[model samples]
Target: MAIHELAVNAVKYGALSSPEGHVTVVWHVEDRDGAQCLRIEWTETGIPVIAHAPRRSGFGTELLTQTVPYQLRGTSTLTFKPGGLQCIIELPAKGVLQ
Candidate 1:
């Protein structure tokens, strides 16, 4: 999936919603339980605040909860913290192309 959508969504409502907010994405290939896998950590900082999760799901939620995992055979978890949102994704490295 094109990350542009995700970035756009973030800019519109999530991490990038505020001028001071920032997003950091990091991914690496490593051995987990003896299996090669790609682990991604998405962290958001400087968010004004996080009251709670959205009552309704939207494109961002769908992409993170459904699209990325189902399409890429990955497992993902999204957490909403008072500080910011944190997303973690891990997938088989064999399925990835470099």
Candidate 2:
């Protein structure tokens, strides 16, 4: 549902708001910090403006920063870029299907 939140946000204020914009999501399994992990990258481009990070945590932030990592027993990093929001998630590979 992380992607869903991002899509909803995109439709509301980011890339997906415009016909020329788009979002890219990629994932793979790899060894990280000596442990197997499912790595995912969420990138957005052509949004036309940069969205500054909110000062306080919101539902979307809570999902990306707390729920996902905690649920997967891993970690996540959410970045606000000049182009748009970028999120990197690393989930423990214990239950990830190869």
- Candidate number with greatest TM-score: 2
Error of 1 at 93 (Å): 1.0
Candidate 2 residue-wise lDDT, 1-98, digit = tens: 87788889889888899887889999999987798888889888887777677678778879988888678777878888776878888888878765
Residue ranges of candidate 1 with Cα displaced over 4 Å: none
Stretch of 10 with least lDDT, candidate 1: 1-10
TM-score for all predictions? 0.83, 0.84
Question: Model 2 Cα displacement at 44 (Å)?
Answer: 0.4
Candidate 1 residues 1-98, lDDT tens each?
42565577678777799988889999899888898998888888777667666688777778878987788888878888876878888889885846
- lDDT for every model? 0.78, 0.83
- Native RMSD of candidate 2 (Å): 1.8
Q: How high is the lDDT of residue 20 in model 2?
A: 77
Q: 53 in model 2: Cα distance from truth in Å?
A: 1.8
